[model samples]
Target: MKSSTMLKAATAVLALAAPAAAQDVTLRIQTHYNPEQTSGKLATEFVEDVEAMSGGAIDIEMFYASSVVATVETFDAAANGILDCDMTGGAYQTGKNPAFQFVGDIMGGYDTPYQQLSWLYYGGGKEQAQDLYNQFGMELIGWWVYGQESLTSTTPVAGPDDLKEWKFRSPPGMETEIFANLGASPIVMDFTEVFTAMETGIIEGTDYSGLANNQSIGLFDLAQHATYPGFHSMPSDHLACNKMVWDGLSDQHKRIIETAMEKLALRSALFFEKANAEAAAELAEKGVTLHNWSAEDRATFRKAAQAAWDDWATRSPEAAALVESHKSYLTQLGLISQSE
Candidate 1:
């Protein structure tokens, strides 16, 4: 009887340990998009893919639309160990670290998002990128494009002159400088609050991702007019992991995450291009006027971008090198003139 009782007790103990004994890891991924947006969709896909690949050993709980942490403070949360990982735009953390603004600034003139990623991952930028984040106790996972940000306003803007004295809602960092250089007052506002700000007349205009984002955030409803020439953001969302959490991840898990992010990076860029094209067409059919930047206007924007780049570069030597390298690349490609 005693032997039988002991065997039963052991069986119960085994049963209790089964789930955890197999493997156990949980990572919290925080982002600023609602669960319905494109970035949210991609984030969901990434989480599921990682779980499936790990065979249930790893789990990532997504905190979307800043449910767990506010958008403005996500970088700080991830760095301070409040969150394990974050999918956020590099520029949003401008106040935390100015060097990060270089990521968004260098892309203003790049022809394709892929080229920017190439420079970041393989073109010697990663060292500086990691160093910038190292100061904040975070590790740079990689970069992902968020699509070109278009201007949306209640009032029409044909050129830089029209932007003067206009209150424009924008994300932080280079975007603020971008609009400021164009003579618009760049108001730093949470992306989620943009729609309300427009409706209440708190801000006159704003810029956000192509179509889905504009519609999802209800920007189109408040601001009927839309314009192209997303001069502010050659925008890309940077993925980051807390240094402590990253170090704790098994080498195998680290490799898996790295490989997955690389594929997702390409997938995300293509998705943005596709989504932007489709969304733009749908909005146009709905009677939204799509303003195209004229040759003269494009040149003016280029000049503004250059001035903004120079202003940021002067703040940090590393930033200056990044800006110079990107310009050199563009000059060699004949996309922009060296004389500029």
Candidate 2:
């Protein structure tokens, strides 16, 4: 009789735990980061957090390094249901609409990751940015701003005047124009060829990843002189899911994903902050000259970016609206004035 009662008790416990053990859905997500990168490692942590918070109802399979498709195709893949989510920068879709450039990276717009995140969270960017993602058939969960990118330059770019006639590798669009305004000759080239181009004297420097990432890739070794606490080009990577799938999720699961994404963004920004600091100290010991531009120099670069931003806005109506919204919000924060 006692044994029978114990069996019943055991069965009840098993019944209660069974639901938690059975995962309701498994999401296939893809990102452009490699597994070895700090961002990639943090992304894996986010996956673990979601599963834990969902009590095993959710499982995420991370495909890193653009293994499933090219980086630019990630958003479309999520929209078409080829993948459940796209974890990449929105700038890749600028080819589809210029509005994406605003959503991706507002080069020289915000000085720090925190300010950019503030614009997204408190300054009404969340809703406005969501509309752009909705048009592409994906839901923008949130963004992880990696902070400003440092440049690897063979010549010391200590001030704006130093940029005059300086040949360097540059990405297309706003970056090219902004530097061109400063009288720098920006050469458009594939990122893979930056090292070779610099080596062959085709370019003198490359505006590349954050200091830590650039160090990992050996850019500092070749360039010798570098820029730190970069004042230009901070891009935002997003976690966007298919709207249909997102809408289908229960409110509880949706909250779990949303909350986890918020945590992921903060953690990612913090990681790069610490990593870049460490990289600077270590590189300095190795005799690399890391330059930080003066306040006046940074402002000059931003002023140059103004015309580029306005020029890009003319590419599409959506782009024009986004640019207006940004200007309005910046004015509200006293970050900009209409006359400037």
**Top candidate, metric TM-score:** 2
Task: Give the Cα lDDT of each candidate.
Answer: 0.76, 0.89
Query: How well does candidate 1 score on lDDT at residue 106?
Result: 53
Give the per-residue lDDT digits (tens) of candidate 2, residues 92-124. 889988999998998888877888888889988
Cα shift from native, residue 127, model 2 (Å): 0.5
Compared with the true structure, what per-residue lDDT tens digits does model 1 show for residues 23-109?
A: 468988888777787778888888888888888788988899898777778888888888988788777766655556776445357
Distance from true position, residue 283, model 1, in Å?
2.1
Candidate 2 residue pairs in clash (backbone atoms < 3 Å): none
Ten residues in a row with the worst lDDT in model 2? 17-26
The TM-scores of all predictions, comma-separated, are 0.82, 0.91
Estimate candidate 1's RMSD in Å. 6.5
- Judged by whole-model lDDT over C-alpha atoms, candidate 1 comes out at 0.76
Q: Candidate 1 has what TM-score?
A: 0.82
- What stretches of model 1 exceed 4 Å from their correct place? 1-24, 104-107, 189-202
